[model samples]
Target chain A: MNSHLILRTVSKFLIPLIVVYGLYVHFHGDFGPGGGFQAGVIVAAAVVLYALIFGLDACKVAVPPSWIRIGMTTGVLLYVGTGVVTWLLGGAFLDYDVLRNNPDHPAGQHLGIILVELGVLFTVATVMVAIFYAFGSRTPDISDEDW
Target chain B: MLNLINAAAAQAGNVPPTLIIDICLMAMLVVVAFAIVRIRSLFAIVMLQGVYSLLSAAWFVSLDAVDVAFTESAVGAGISTVLMLSAMLLTDRKSAPVPVKKALGPLMVCVLAGAAMFYAIPDMPAFGDPDSPANTGPGMEYMTASVKQVEVPNVVTAVLASYRGYDTMAETVVIFMAGLGVLLLLGLNGNAGFWQAKVQGQNICTQAAPRARILTSPSDKPNTEPRAPGDPEPSSKNTSVKKVAAKKTAARKTAAKKPATKRTTSKKAAKKPAKPKGEAS
Candidate 1:
């Protein structure tokens, strides 16, 4: 097969692996060298790879640029929302201890981490695709008629 | 030499791998930035800029600043580079590398900033010492307590959204404002009519400049529909021919309409039959 076909085929398999690894890093961050940010980028890279094989139009059809921007905003909002939730519970901005007055429960931390990571993933992935389209659509200056 | 050796011996404490990586990444970052700035080709510069951002991300990662790394790599390397290249496409190529003529001002500012940041670091915890104030402070206390109250595990999330709820709200508002500004500047709602004209122009040029035959003369195929007419086609030969042909056709049509002038001359020549008769004699 030609390189384009090969790359497309390979990317299909590669994206899943990247996403899985991203989740693994995100969840296992406390014990390892990865976290929400790393995981988000890894997943975003998978989407970006998809954009590379397909044209910007095809990629937009799959994942609209507007949706990507929304996703980015959503991630930030989600991250901020978690803090707001904690603050409403009578805790200082992010004092989770005051969230329920229970210091031993890991559930709050788990919930917060998952939401934040999801947000990061959304922002990172969408931005990645946006940039890909921006660069790919560039018009070359090879034409000299204007000159 | 003896005093230097003793000082070195005293400083042989085990350094964290993160610190080592940070130092090494910083050096690599400098080299990559130099290469990017020095590169002549626009294409090469774009690629190098990507490398520079990636290196910066790696540096942030080494410092355990995951969020900053994510933003830098994703936005800086991925999107910003694309935007820059897209802007570059509308311009020239093979220009000389942008020269650094006024380095003294920037260098001084950089040195001042570096010194300030360095001075600030000493008052902060010494690179991930678990016993540092940050680990024992209310931030840490809040994280431990958050497990009970909020049932959340990620302290960073709790700190960013809840602990700094007001900040998050302000940030959201700021982003919304920025988005609104962008919409005002490039929105389809108000500027549709303006951009439509530009789109038509671009379309004509694009149609005229066949993607498959970009390098060849356009005169070879005069029947092809232009992608965008108002926009100039970049090919040199085809445009000139099209212009010349258009002028020639117009001139021919005007000349054809004035057949009366030519007929008058022919009629005068017909009356001069003696001219031929004299020649014959």
Candidate 2:
């Protein structure tokens, strides 16, 4: 059917746009309706879209399990590490005030928020993909006729 | 229409036009939810669930919880549907209808719980009540402080990332654990021999017909390998390079009885297994 061809062509076109939009949402959270959580899911949806079109095997080839694991770990570490850094800087745990030099400017809060959100982006994106992989991989070999 | 005028008036904050949009969305949601309950096909149910999620996401946006709306659509409608479809492949497509007797207890519980919630609704603050405790409490402090101290234009991000950092971190940990649980239940390889998977495996998930992929796309197969020609095709044109255990072996057992020839019928027996080797190894 032309539907298959359309899906393939459309997905190829849409994947990059989705990923970029996800990044936009990630960075633009401060001024608009977004955050790391939403951004991460959007980015993962791109990968999921890729998987749906190209097949899960090809999808996994593009993003391996090991890389997914690293992403999840890095996201959590980056988040807590910022907290630990703040603690080391002599503020209460997760206090963003110590992140900047000048007390007058909200620079510390700004930096801390960005870093923490980045961490959330990392974890949320990888976890969603990882969950997808787990489910996708475990599937039995069902053909199109099964429907 | 008068309704359009009412909607516009509501937007100007004088008339609270919650009923128009909210009623339409809620009615659709209820219908979809009921349809999902009655549907015998798991596939249809999954699709309906996505519809429900989208409806709810739109409702969330109407309620001014744009952030929540964003998540509900993506995670709930987008990813969850895909995940459910994949998971469904492993099970029977049609769900067995539940016995009325067996369903009664849960149905009663649901009705009672819904009744209790409805009764409690009167005590709850009206939507967007500025005098409400939630709006006036430390939540107000977070909002005001975010502008002056955090300087972030969107207070939601400021609250989630800064003021409620620990809560967000805990939520992240919870997500991480959910991933962990799925990984434990289903190996990323989805193969029986988890250890057998090579360091540079071509595919992790055997989603579609495994061997069919290699046949359809020649460039994807490593031409250097002499075994490409001998790789057991699914006979019926299924795909996957990973050795799916059940069907292939049964097919090979029959093929093993037939003499090994390089024809389509002689798929399984050509190699070592008397039957065709399901994998390249």
Candidate 3:
């Protein structure tokens, strides 16, 4: 992979754009055709591309396995925490309206969606990365000649 | 002939453009599917599957299901392809040939399922019909009130994240559980140390102890051991060896100064390699 100058240079150029696009899709999801799930996948694809061009160890060093594991758990916690907070605010579980002081407020809904989407983004991205790490870390039992 | 064609085009108006795109995409999808079935190489099949996903995403875009299209393109075409390739690295590239007799039962089941679905299709309501239950149900309410109620322009997001928040939460939890399951099954042994050992053709204990030793190995002793067979010669290995050596020396010096630090360092050194040794074959 290090010998392939073309791939390394081209990927270095493309990775940033891909990541930026993923973030754009994430934050602009409310007004656009993308959301947390799509954006998360896009971001993960960027990391995977980097892994493909570079190596798995390099990718792991860039985004550590432990951090990804933590991120996976944190995302679920964030999603459930939002629900719990709303419940504690004297509303039903996942009732975003009660998040704000004014019941039936659009602000509360907006905030709730943003938080939930963020949670989704975290879980999706980390899970995909973790899966990649798992698969990438293994030694291929077969060789190219076998194929 | 040109005049007749122009007249027909004028008559058809906006419908032809979309219909043409739809037909083209569907034809490509069918071709890709056939290729997938005909090909014995798992690599080519994985690539064709990604192509299929992209084609379907294009179709979804034409149908105005842009969000679904985005997801199909990113997850189905992109991440899944990479994941499949990664998994492929562990398995054989060529699929084992199936005997005709062995395949017949599965083929019959597939045909039966396809026929059943086709038979049910005509009973369904027309696509995008206003009177259809989907359009007339809560979807209508979401479309009408979501902007004002949720202040989000994307009604789908508003509905998913706010109105039907519980369902979305459940979906997230499901994804989390999947990650947890994979981690539980694969994560512990899926580290560089495990693979390094597997590559070197050494027993697990010998491999594990060396890594701990490498971490605590004196800086003065250069890693003069011959490179493993088939391992690539890269400069990064030299740098990494030096870095590891430096850290180990620093740790040793600190341990000499403080017996308390020595106990903690020794405990960590003992624990780190022990876990991997227990799991490694």
What does chain B score (TM) in every candidate?
0.55, 0.64, 0.62
Best by TM-score: 2
Model 3: which docking level applies?
acceptable
Clashes of 2: 10
Q: What's the CA error at residue B256 for candidate 1, in Å?
A: 39
Question: Where does model 3 exceed 4 Å of error?
Answer: A102-105, A140-147, B1-15, B102-120, B188-281
Tally clashing residue pairs in candidate 1: 31
C-alpha root-mean-square deviation, candidate 2: 9.5
**Order by DockQ, highest first:** 2, 3, 1
For candidate 3, write residues B41-95 as lDDT tens digits. 9999999999999999999999899999999989899988988987776666789
Window of ten residues with lowest summed lDDT in model 1 chain A:
A138-147
Over the true interface, candidate 1 deviates by an RMSD, in Å, of: 18.6
| Native contacts, share recovered per candidate | 0.14, 0.70, 0.65
Lowest summed lDDT across 10 adjacent residues in model 2 chain A is found at: A138-147
Candidate 2 local lDDT, A107-146, one digit each (tens): 8988898889888999999989988776665442333434
Q: Compared with the true structure, what per-residue lDDT tens digits does model 3 show for residues A68-128?
A: 7788888888989998999999989987888877655568877788888888999999999
**Ranked candidates, highest lDDT first:** 2, 3, 1
In candidate 3, residue A63 scores what lDDT?
75
How far in Å is the alpha carbon of B16 misplaced in model 2? Answer: 4.6
Candidate 1 lDDT over A41-135, as tens digits, reads 66666666565565433455666556756876786777676668777987655444444444455455455555655665555555555444444
Each model's lDDT: 0.55, 0.76, 0.74
